[model samples]
Every structure is written in structure tokens, then in C-alpha cells.
Target: MAQEGKLDLLLKTVEENKKRRVEAKERARVDFVGLKVVVEGRLPQVEKKVSDLGKVLGVLSTKVEQLESTVSRQARAELLPEDIREEHLDASPSLSTPLIRGSV
Candidate 1:
């Protein structure tokens, strides 16, 4: 009789453990589904943010290109006058006397 009672108690304990395990699995599944839903809901917002940032970067790149072009034109303009003056001087040979040979 004692052995039969012990066997019944062991079976009960086993059953309780199985029930707890099943409950734990169900809770984990529910939590995982909730997490997935939350992440899915936020995905579009994240994508929009990324897209906005890309647009901002593109605008900045265009601005930089424009600035570089302006700078390039300004630099050429600054140096061009000097080059023209030198050319003009070279073209006018009669303005300066030519150096004679063997005369320092």
C-alpha cells in the first residue's frame, strides 16, 4: 500500500511539471508574437526616417557641388586677369628694348 501511494504521488508531480512547462511555452509564444507585431508596426516609421535622411544628404551634396563650382569659377576669374596682362606685355615688343648679346 505504501509503494502504491508513493507511485501516485510521483505521477502527480510529473503531471504538474508537464502542465507548468506547457504554460511557460504558451507565454513565451505570446510574448514573441507581441514583439513581432511591435517591430512590424515601427518598421515603416524607421524606413521613412531613413528616406528623409537620404534626401537631406542628397540636398547637402548638391549644395556642396554648387559651392565647389562657384569656387572654381572664382579662382579662374582671379588668375585670368594676370595671365592676360602678361600676354599683352609679351605681344608688345616695342615697349621694352631687347637685350644685346654679351651685355649683362
Candidate 2:
């Protein structure tokens, strides 16, 4: 059609989209407030559960770290030569590929 008609259609579409967006945003805001209220009501319980989980995780992490260290010590004592024990300990992630190749 004419340029003015096309512009008018575009303006109408933009306004309709703006209205829909505003409505969607308001609905989302209401849902968020309701969700916040629900979460807030359960705050103490959630905090307690989170705290317990943290304690369990902390204990697990400590045990894992201790196990790793023990395994590392035993491996060094058994498999590694004495001269390279310290060097190997320091070399574990110290080496890198000399070349960087991208897609062949």
C-alpha cells in the first residue's frame, strides 16, 4: 500500500505489542510478589535446611580432602621414585600443550 498506510500499521502493531508487554510484566510482577510471600513465609525452615545441608557438605568435603591427601601420599611413597616425588608433586598441572590448533 502507501507509505503512510504502512507506517500507520507499524504504529498500531507497536502499540499493541507495548500493551501486551505491559500486561505480561504486571502479571509477572504479581506472580513474583506471591512467590516472594510464599518464600518469605518459609524462610526460617529453608534457612535451617540449607544450614544442615551446608554442614553435611562441609563434612563430606573435609573427608574427601583427607582421603585425597592420604591417597596422594601413599601413591608417592609406592609408585614414584624418591628423586622425582617433589618434582612430580609440583608438576601435576604444570605442563601445557606447546601448540594450539583450531578446527582442522
Candidate 3:
């Protein structure tokens, strides 16, 4: 009778564990679905923002190149005599133009 009782208790525990496992699996599946839905819903907006950022990066890159070029020209001009510097500046009007803050 004791052995039978032990067997019954073991069976009951096994069944409870199985039930818990199934419940856990169902919860995980539901959570995954909810996460998928959320990600899918935001994916387009995220992509668009990324694209916009890429455009801004491209613009910023162009401005950096322009600034680098202007700095290079100014450096070269400083190495030259005043008369040549004036002539060089005259040849490239942009080199002499004062940069307004935030204009780029």
C-alpha cells in the first residue's frame, strides 16, 4: 500500500510538471507573437527614420568636404605672399567668403 501511494504521488507530480511546461510554452508563444506584432508595426517607421538619418549624414559629409577644401585653400593662401594670396582669393570667391554659423 505504501508503494502504491508513492506511485500515485509520483504520477501526480509528473502530470503537474507536464501541465506547467505546457502553460509555460503557451505563454512564451503568446509573448513572441506580441513582440512580433510590435516590431512589425514599428518597422516601417524605423526604416524611414534610418533613411532620413542617412540623408542627413550625406549632407553633413558634403559640408565637411567643403569645409576641408576651404581650410586647405586658406592654408595654402597663408603660405603665399599677400599679393598672391589676394589673387588666389580673387580666383576662388568661396575661399574669401566668411562662413556664417550654422549655414552648412
User: What's the CA error at residue 7 for candidate 1, in Å?
Assistant: 3.3
Q: Please, what are the lDDT tens digits per residue for candidate 1 over residues 27-98? A: 999999999999999999999999999999999999999999999988778877779789788888664444
Q: Rank the candidates by lDDT, best first.
A: 1, 3, 2
8-70 in candidate 3: lDDT tens per residue? 999999999999999999999999999999999999999999999999999999999999999
Model 2's alpha-carbon lDDT is 0.90
* Model 1 residue 26 CA deviation in Å: 0.5
Q: Which residue pairs show backbone clashes in model 3?
A: none
Cα misplacement distance, residue 68 of candidate 2 (Å): 21
Q: What is the lDDT of residue 65 in candidate 3?
A: 100
- Model 2 TM-score, all chains together: 0.44
- Any runs in candidate 2 off by more than 4 Å, and if so which? 48-104
lDDT of 2 by residue, 1-104 (tens): 69999999999999999999999999999999999999999999989999999999999999999999999998777765765877877878854454544333
TM-score, each model? 0.56, 0.44, 0.75
How many clashes show up per model? 0, 0, 0
* Residue 4 lDDT (model 2): 94
